[model samples]
Target: MPSKKPELLVPLNGWKTLHNSSTVLDSADAFYFGLQTNFSMRARADNFPIKDLLKLIEMVHDRGKKCYLTTNILIYNTEMVELYQTIQLAHESGVDAIICHDLAAILIAKEVGIPFHVSTQANISNLLSAKFYQELGADRLILARELDLNDIKEIASKLDIPIETFVHGAMCTAVSGRCYLSAELMDFNPDFSANRGKCVQPCRRNYTLEFTGEENEKIDFEPYSGMFFNAKDLCMIGHISELIEAGISSFKVEGRMRDPEYIETTAKCYREAIDSYFNGTYSQKRVDEWLSRLSKVFNRGFHLGFYFSKPGSDDIERTIRGNQAKLRKIQIGKVTNYYPAASAVEVQLFQNHLEIGDTIIFENKNGFYHKQQVKSLQIEGESITNTKKMSTTQPIIVGIKVSKKIPNTAVIYKFIKKTTSKMKKKID
Candidate 1:
């Protein structure tokens, strides 16, 4: 029931993101990433080096996808010159658009003659602000995360430009992520501010309530100890139809600081959801399956976020402190060699043991990933059922039958499944 199919905008953290999303999944319609510089959000992430900008852009373009460079950080007066250079370099490297919020960054993008997408940091929650950005030549508007589906529809109905919104990922406790808590905690350190993209997430910590009496005595309340401000991750897999019908131009998935495996699962799951919606295969059963798959990846549990209405106490992630993923991956070995004709790879074990019927993932440094169940394992080309844990000094080598070619630089990780009856105390 959408006017048109929306774009699946994904995040790029590093080389793994490039390989997994582009090669392993091939799902993203566009990718948004930050550079090594601090002008963009997710400054703590393993951002791409500026020297690789041209090559990275070429890689995405070769696959017929667009690249949007992120320069959405709050700019100080001293950083204007460097910001201009960054936007200029993005323009030179054939970037599709520069995602930014600061007026200086917006002006610089315009000066450098490049398209710009207003970031959610702009907080364009209403029609007036949406039209303002549209008039300012914003190719796309990433509306505030605080807006509900009705508000989104109302604004999208009046806007001519494409309107983008967060369909999934971490929901900041603050309005549109304009938080000073991290900065205040760091004693006004600009490098640690949420607006500067390096939030330490003090809000996610379990805090207790303390009371001071007239005698200067302190009392602690044990019942109030909880992660009150830790917002549950946004998941719209079940509501893809509603989101599409809201006239959103793009569905953005947050998590630039997450691992590559997280990126792969999220991108693939959302991609399937969106495609299924358009292909007339969207169903509650499929949604359930997608939710199960999503729960296996990195998340702080799931919620509908502000799409339906204001979040209440039920929306807050009160118990789990870290990831609530149902599965954990452990690196066990690396591919030492690949046999194309035999469809096999020589693996050198570094740690844990591997056996038949085990689920494993092959990750390449050059940007390729594959997951398969270990149906075939061999030692010196002879059939084997399992192998012992290899030592670091005298590592054990074995042959694995792969479905496709795996690079020599590819690392292997075994998936450790968990039960739903009880949650693990340590999540890793």
Candidate 2:
């Protein structure tokens, strides 16, 4: 068998509701096996609470995965000490490494005896900067997104330290994310000096195009049009071999503020694609399938972006829209306590209509849905002939324990119909 492919580094910003729970990390570990928690959004000067940070790091580590703490924000004099303290705490808490952009912060990280990775914010587009970081004891360098295949190959040939590059996801119009557009427009600076956590994404806002007529007469070319700086989402899932050959050690996905389902799906896709590419049988059909799945989540339209060159007019999508919610065909029930000695399973049903012999499907951490026949039922501690009017507190007993330990949040649902003859003919 071929060697297992290297893992992708998924950076999460803890913006969506799922990132607030332990289940998100659990799901990520189950799917991706590696993650990077971004502190750029969470580490404000006033809101430097380490409770959630510690919890997230602990959960990631507990799953036997690596967690890199991001100190990749633009730091000012006022926030320097607080940032250092945060880095120190992260180091003490056994974080894998600190991702830093500022040289001063990198120095502080070095003094604290924690390994450092240069953040992409530093704009290491050339081989010299990569070499410089390697000599500075940096273990990894996130390359600027503007670099093409040739640039990557040149840098890879010269660098000794591990190189990380964005394999898929959003593209920033700014050079290496160094744009002052948000700060300049909102009057809230976000560069190397003033470290403000709140960034009003000025790039994604609307704009109106104006035209100049004869003798300085102005005309409205396009009214109230948006996507002014909206670069298309980068999708390089189709080009894995070229990237791996360019010596990229880690393929990074850029969705720090996206949903957990987005994280789960995207990470899993890249995980599989990387494996297939290395095994020498990667296909375009598989890439299309993964991209289609991603479309169901969220996106600003897809593009190959600057990976090839400066993105053309066709590379950008001019409009923005939200993804429609796709409801899952499952229902959740109250969890039960497991007892191996009694060989009995108990679950609280949301609907009281389930019979003893009814078959139902259940989902677990493995993402596999299993169908099982219920052999028996009991209410309370005694056996009951019928449980037609069961209450929420009453535990409904089943015959067989699920193959996998049912997570507290496990959802169960009975299939209403197996197949439709007409639908099958349409598919055929």
Candidate 3:
């Protein structure tokens, strides 16, 4: 029998990125999403409306894939009924599994006859705790993010259940995301708990230092000096081989509240890298290419956290400027049709404007990535040098030569034209 390919479990950020998930469904083995209830970690995300969520589960199951419902939030006494209702909904919706951080969710999963996976928030770092979960009938274990590769390998070797880990995206300073910094600050709201999915992210706040007294020992720290707790994002494309070797059954992506483009780009990159590594065609050039794709999204800056070694002070970024989204591409257009005989594509402008010589790419629904240059543009069959934003009635038509099979309704992204001062001076 052939060994199973490592699964890539991507996040469903919210309703806005739902369209983008189609691009990644083929690449991802499973998808985990949250709902509007307390059972989610991303209450800030759109999650899914009840009707849409049920439809989403059916859609995913129809594709012959698994869908995991995330109920990984801490449970309060008052919220028990609501939590169980969510679990029942997940069960009735035919979700393959439930990821839970709360004991209440685990008990409910058992009653609902659905399998459960312990969320990383459970802090299952050692073999004994893992055995405890397995004894509880847990189907999978998403071990804490703090476990190093050696520890993961050792644990996997000892356990029968599959092991999952966060391979890319953000990391939390607190172990297993047990954080209280948000609720303690900013007027101390009783309802805003990061564990419960309403985090204000006080860690991303900046700080500074100041002098407060006559004595030399009276030097005081300034307010808003730097992001002391702001951790860098994790990128493990370079370590794909080691992770697969560690017997990790799943490599999870961490962003669910980010832009859809970010979701599509990151998933596609990792999917290709994993396929290449296992097929014996892995190369440094390919690794570098995937890294470049990761940079196109918002990051807290990139690092391989606790995965390889003990994190030092260097792992945590202490800068005033936080890493937001860097790779911001505009949705300049979309393909309405393709003409093979002419070796061209028909795209309607959606946002921004594109010139004839601009660099852009055509992203298909199946996550196919293709780069092409704008060779021609026409409106009403008349030639034009450039195209601007247009309405449905007067959208511009772009003809770019292509070789690959472009899927119907592919998104076209115009690469931002970055011109430096020196280059501008030369042009002037």
Q: Evaluated with TM-score, which candidate comes out highest?
A: 1
Residues 16-98, model 1: lDDT tens digits: 67654444238888899999997878998878889999999998998888989999989999888788889999999999999
Our tally of clashes for model 1 stands at 1
Index of the highest-lDDT prediction: 1
What is the model-wide C-alpha lDDT for candidate 2?
Answer: 0.64
Q: lDDT (0-100) at residue 316 of candidate 3?
A: 75
- The alpha-carbon lDDT assigned to residue 355 of candidate 3 equals 77
Residue-by-residue lDDT tens digits, candidate 2, 66-124: 77766776676787777778778878877888878888779999999998889888889
lDDT of 3 by residue, 218-299 (tens): 5655444566787888999998989998899999999888766677778898899889887888899999888877876767
Ranking by lDDT: 1, 3, 2
Model 3 lDDT at residue 32: 89
TM-score for each predicted model, relative to the true structure? 0.89, 0.68, 0.80
